[model samples]
Target chain A: METIAKQGARVQLQLNGRVREGFAEPRTQLCDFLRHELGATGVHVGCEHGVCGACTVQVDGKSVRSCLMLAVQAQDSRVDTVESLAEGELMSDLQLAFRRNHALQCGFCTAGILMSCAEFLGREPDPTESQVRDMLSGHLCRCTGYTGIVRAVLEVANERKSKNGEK
Target chain B: MKPASFDYVRPTRKAEVLELLSEYGQDARIIAGGQSLMAVLNMRMTQPKLLIDINRVEELHFIEERKNCLAVGAGVPQVELLSWPRISETVPLLALAMPWIGHFQTRNRGTVCGSVAHADPSAELPLCLKTLGGEVVLESRSGSRTVTAEAFFQGILTTDRRPDELLTEVRFPLCKPGTEYRFNEVAMRHGDFAIVSLAAVIGAGTIRLGIGGVADRPVTRDFEPGQDLSAALNETAWSLDAQDDVQATAAYRRQLVRDLGRRLIEEGH
Candidate 1:
């Protein structure tokens, strides 16, 4: 517990299928580190206290609030930011559904919501509207009223289910 | 808001964590999952000189069935515990209440022990522990000691844990036969902190009720099935000393205790 001098520590993590390296002070949050140091701006930072859910990202395949985690804690882990959701200009089905359903307006909360939906849909491929609404509870959108987001998520789920040939 | 400057250390072994705790006592804070602690840090509510990250301590990540209780370690995340294969059969009350703890994003990284250690009055895990008479294990360099949930939670955002002691695990007693449980809460939104939460355990001859978010700490009482149930619930509600806050009025909370208490009791029956 001896206090050391304040300084930046080296942090390396697999971000968006790439090994990214950066330096973070002990007090640096994962969101700030990803955006400021590692240049992953897709991980937004609305509330640094974990309530706004604008900083959601995947660490080891689980969606978490980047604001609530230290960058040093994510070392050696696999992280997925919203930048990884698409394949070189091609939007993922969920993103396309959001566009088709007009799910986003301000676009400030879109990245985090998409990250959360990606993880949720990966686990539950055929979620009901209520389930999707429950998942959206984690996120706060000043725009859209969450109706289109819910519709978009359910639409993607239905599309994925039929493509997988599951009833 | 950014956290104040501090030295961070990830201890790979439980012993290392214990040693750090022993050395720093009140100056060192253990960071497991960092769900609650991070928020406080960002707000500068606490400025510990050093943060001992225990996520790398592999020995502390486990959920074991020990005789009459389920022991959850400090490193076991809430999501993992919620998804445990035998959780519903082993601890049905927890199974019924886990989803109400937080949102899916937070639960993926928040630890069960972390929430108990944080000792938020409205949190589901602490209320569950108190209602089930669970035990909390506090470990330090010198030794380890176990405290019952009732004795562990001292007040709002407080606990009986010493500065040098680390909350290593919490043991929830296994559900007994012929006993039924029902948990419900009223919150502004799903995943928000409960305005008033209630847990009821109905046994063969007794009904135990635990109430949270209406007091400084979660409170519990036992009532005989043959007694005046409404009167007893009213007395218990009055004894909680509810206060007026932004989320709810003191009178409204008391009313919830009287009404929700009755409904939960009936549901259990």
Candidate 2:
């Protein structure tokens, strides 16, 4: 009876295109909620601390650390995760460029990097190398040497610009 | 690591927050932004019986332009502060230091008052506040009291903040004419905590410098606008007794003070 009473405040989250709800402690971590509770294991948790930036996810159009946020804080909010970058195995241009450029090695840090880069480069077509570096500074990869990662982003930028008749 | 289970408390009213803090006293620990506090709990460094979730307290999250200064509420996310163009233009140093506090991920979740309450020596906001001569307003069951930056800090990782008191907001002074400012920090990476961070402000024919991560607490140096660089270093370090730790040696930071102080003074000129 007490256990039944404990589950209060069902938060409405728009994950991908579907609406989902979860009743959790106000302190339940968003990452844990996404993984253990919701079975969306695509969102990897590399560092529980904020340093690694691995658990990044889109919280209402803003990239945020799922590890650092509470599930309840995102009540009645929309969320997008790595799994949403593709739909039924179709990938976005940035995702394909990452593949074509051999950007990822271990693949653990890819999703967060992809989400952040997708948002950043979508708004910026002709970003400088330093701007790319600065924007990507937060996401860390222990596998790739960062050369392929940066190059892959440049590849996407050139391809996207050429396709759009941009300089 | 999973945090030890504890009773959760979310108080909506300021008076309710004050009362909860008083009722729990030392056994109660506040969470805002949870940047540092969450890490503390995860590490088992602190296990407060009552976890006061101040993030739900609506009054704590604000960025209002007060009569004499900018009143930044405790719950104002660090990212929101950076995104505010007016804050960037009006409080340039604070703007400059925000990105350096943590990566975008951390800043998105970190809070202004959480930075002050944790009072890490290397943290950016403390030095920014110290350099700007900001004031912190503390609220408790009794009433409110303001502590100037210089007097607010007590020692390393410590403040004059009482156990029962909650820091409600931080007040940053309005910039004056000719107020050129510079914030510089060196880390292994750009966003990592600084080995030594300096916030230098020049205005009103005076020079104000705040040094962090070089001492037990932030140390400030005030000089006549045109004072010589070497003299400023000697007075600020030797007279003030800057402390050092594992990140970099004490002597190295002292030398950095001289080098950075010289550069900032010239830049401010």
Candidate 3:
């Protein structure tokens, strides 16, 4: 195993389905690398110590705190930020539901919440209200008091379940 | 805040990791999952010259069942252990306490051994490990040693691990038949550190109660299940030397130990 110098190292990853490369030191957090070097501005950086979920992103299909993961550690991994949640101008079903419920006030925590909810609903396609709330507890949304976020997540879960039934 | 600058190495093998540890000694730090270490780094609490990333070490990513215990490797994430199919039947106490460790997002990347290695007094894993009489495996280029949980944790955020040793795995004794277990904690929020955490294991005639957050480290005491325990519980609570903090006062912590301890002991019956 070779040690990369503290000066910097080239970290390459599949970011939101695109292969992106960025130069970062060993201490550079993934959230910073994404926003600054890889042009992923949606990866919000709040409470860089991992308490606030504003830096939450998906690494290899699992939602994790980007602030807690160093860029060097995410090398060669498939990473997904909030930018992947939308296609062109088409918002994902979960995003549409959030809009309908008005789940955001300041919208600072919405990206992280959406990323977590998206990963969660994939695992649990038909979660109960309490389960949705439990998943939402990982994220902090001081503006909305979390009522609308919970409703939006539950609504997406039910819609997905019914849509799968229609098939 | 960003972490201090440091060189990084991702070792693919456990031997390579041990070699790095042996060479760097106190100047090197092994990073697994980086859930806790990253937070500490961001705060600039302790800066290491070399950061060894062991996430790619395939040998350390395992959760195997042993003769009388479950062996979890250093690479096994908390979420993986929590969702293990046999956890509820094998280690019921751990299954109950796993959810309170951290939030779902953090657990997704937080390794089980990492939390045990961190040895936070308010953490649930250490309390459970102490109560269950688990063992921690510390390996280095010199040799390997296994330390009992009772003697492994020394103080708040301190452990018996040496600078040249890596916490390779943790062995949790499997639940025995006729033994009942109960785990409870009081925290400001669902995923926050516990102000006071209690784990009770009741067997045929003996009951063992482990308390956390009120002391520098998790402490355990054994007693006869048939006897009255109020006085003993109060005495044990006061002996912990609880201190006043922003989240909780010394008196409230002691009260929690007495009240929550009694409740868990009775609930196990």
lDDT of 3 at B173: 99
**TM-score for candidate 3:** 0.98
Q: Cα deviation in Å at residue A32, candidate 3?
A: 0.2
Best by DockQ: 3
Q: Give iRMSD, candidate 3.
A: 0.9
DockQ of each: 0.64, 0.35, 0.86
Off by over 4 Å in 3: none
DockQ of 1: 0.64
| Candidate 1 local lDDT, residue B139 | 92
DockQ of 2: 0.35
Alpha-carbon deviation at A142 in model 2, angstroms: 1.2
Residues B1-269, model 1: lDDT tens digits: 99999888888889889888889999988899888999999999999999999888999999999899999999999999999999999999999999998799999999999999999999999999999999999998889999999999999999999998989999999999999988999999999999999888898998899899989999899999889888989999899999998999999999999999998997552
Model 2: per-residue Cα lDDT over B1-269, one tens digit each: 55566666566767788888888888988887887877677667887777777776788889988778888998898988888879866788887778788776677778888898889988999888888989999999999999998898888779989989999999888777678888887777888778878888877777788888788778788888556768767667665465556666777777778887777778642
Per-residue lDDT of A50-94 in model 3, one digit per residue for the tens? 888998999999999999999999999999999999989999998
CAPRI band for model 1: medium
